[model samples]
Target chain A: MKVRVTVMLKDGVLDPQGKAIGHALQTLGFDGVHDVRVGKVIELDLHGAGEEETHKKAEDMARNLLANLVIEDYSIEVVS
Target chain B: MKVRVTVMLKDGVLDPQGKAIGHALQTLGFDGVHDVRVGKVIELDLHGAGEEETHKKAEDMARNLLANLVIEDYSIEVVS
Candidate 1:
């Protein structure tokens, strides 16, 4: 099975990287862009695990290590 | 309009970050995890642009700045 975890900055959080990216886009002539929020994705391939178990494990990973709960949120999906 | 860009490392590319994450998971007792691939996601909010234009601009960003063509693949989706 394969699971994908997406971790993103929470609402109202200050994202310097995202601000920098937005500014860079404007500098590069992409003036239509309003805001940019940068996040991360993690893909996990597991063997001998059912969909439920895989999702559980992935969610655990996200909550424990992949995300900062105070500022970031994450979602998990089973892809295969 | 809102656009989401997902950037991932291409297969066969070495990902030290992924390896480190996998190792950390095992050390933390999530031993069922096999392989992990780390990627990135960028969310862009655009004002006064149609869906087609937003996607086009996002694709341009991915190609020129957000992703490295040599080792990464990116997909752009218009979410709103």
Candidate 2:
């Protein structure tokens, strides 16, 4: 199975990288952008796992490794 | 309008970050994972733009600033 985990900063967190991107976009003349938030997408390919088990494992990985729970949130989806 | 751009390494490119994560996952006993790829997800909130214009602007931004076309590929999606 293939699972994709999206890890993003929590709503209240400050994202300097995103701010920088927004600023750059404005400077480059694409000025309609008002907000930018950058996040991570982790795609994993697993073998010997059923759909249910794969989802569980991916969630476990997100909780333990992919995201910093204090300031980040994650969502997982099975792609294949 | 809201646009999301996902930027990922080209299929044959080396991804050391992903490999290290995979190794750590195995070491931590989540051994079903065989491959991993890490990518970026950028969400932008734009004002004063129609959906079609937002999509075009996002594609332009991805090509010009968000992605390195030589080694990465980017996909844009309009969320709202």
Candidate 3:
């Protein structure tokens, strides 16, 4: 089975990297760009797990290791 | 308008960060985890653009500055 996790910074958190990217885009002449927030995605392939089990395990992974809970939020999807 | 870009490393590319994350997850006792790959998402809020224009600009942003075309693939979505 395949599990996909989307992790994103919580609102109100300072995202310097995102700010830098936005600035860079503007400098590159992409003036249409405004607010930019950057997040991450983690894809995992697991063997010997059903959909329910895979999602539970992936959720645990996200909570315990994949994301900083106080600053980031994560959602898991069973992709396959 | 809101646009989102998902950037991912191409298959066969070495992802040291992903490897480290997987190793860490294993260390944390999530033994079900395997084959972890990490990517990124960028959300952009733009004003004064229609869906077509927003998507086009976001695609250009991804192709030129948001992602490395040689090693990564990017997809743009009009979120709002």
Residue-wise C-alpha lDDT for candidate 2, range B1-80, written one tens digit per residue: 99999999999999999999999999899887899999999999999999999999999999999999999999999999
TM value for model 2: 0.97
Q: Report residue B42 deviation for candidate 2 (angstroms).
A: 0.5
lDDT of 3 by residue, A1-80 (tens): 99889999999999999999989998998886769999999999887899999999998888888899999998888999
DockQ for the candidates, in order: 0.88, 0.92, 0.82
Q: Sort all candidates by lDDT, best to worst.
A: 2, 1, 3
- For every candidate, C-alpha RMSD to the true structure in Å: 0.9, 0.8, 1.2
The lDDT of model 1 is: 0.92
Chain B, candidate 3: TM-score: 0.94
Greater TM-score among 1 and 3 belongs to 1
Residue pairs clashing, model 1: none
What is the overall TM-score of model 1 with all chains considered together? 0.96
TM-score per model over all chains? 0.96, 0.97, 0.94
Which residue pairs in model 2 clash with each other? none
- Winning model by DockQ: 2
Query: Which docking band does candidate 1 fall into?
Result: high
lDDT score, candidate 2, position B80: 94
Q: Which candidate comes out best when scored by TM-score?
A: 2
